[model samples]
Target: MLIGELAEQAGTSTRMLRYYEAHGLVRPERTANGYRCYDEAELRVVREIRGLLAVGLGLDDIRPFVACLRAGNPSGDACPDSVAVLRRKLAEVDDYIDQLGAVRRQLQTQLAHAITVRPR
Candidate 1:
């Protein structure tokens, strides 16, 4: 199919598909006339890329997942590199959660103090 067909099937914009191509995430073959030609396999690749991006993964972080898919694995996260990236992202999320918890505690303490010292 052509780029527009792929984008419609993938439920993404053609611009995003081009961005993915530019980032080396998806590669579509070119016709003799220089038009991009994508196979059915590229539809799956585009979906995988969109899914990863939805989860906050940047293009650089998503490279391993795309590579995994291209390697003929049933799933992108099946490879060790993709799993490593997942682990790192999970750790970052955990750290952010901890930081938010600390901020919540501090806010609670401040609120309590303000209530206790307010003029009657």
Candidate 2:
């Protein structure tokens, strides 16, 4: 199928497919007339890429999973490298949550202090 068709089937935009190409996330074939051609498998790749991106994963972070899928794995994250990437992302998210918790505590303290020291 063409880029537009693939994007429609994948429920993504043509611009996103182009962006995936630019970032080496999806590899489509080029026709003799220089048009991009995508296979049905590419739809799966696009879905995987979209799923990861929806969870805040960047293009760079998705490369290994893409490679794993291209390598014929049933799941994108089935490979060791992809699993490691997931682990790293999990740790980063945990750290972010911890930081957010601290910020929430600080905000609560500030609110309490203002309540106790409000000007008449």
User: Judged by lDDT, which candidate is best?
Assistant: 1
lDDT of each: 0.94, 0.93
lDDT of 2 by residue, 32-72 (tens): 99999999789999999999999998888898988999999
Worst 10 residues of 1 by lDDT: 35-44
**Taking the tens digit of each residue's C-alpha lDDT, what string does model 1 give over 24-55?**
88899999999899998899899999999999
Q: What is the lDDT of residue 68 in candidate 2?
A: 92
Clashes of each: 0, 0
Residue 54 CA displacement from its true place in model 1, Å: 0.6
Task: Show model 1 residue runs off by greater than 4 Å.
Answer: none
Residue pairs in clash, model 1: none
Q: What global local distance difference test value does model 2 have? A: 0.93
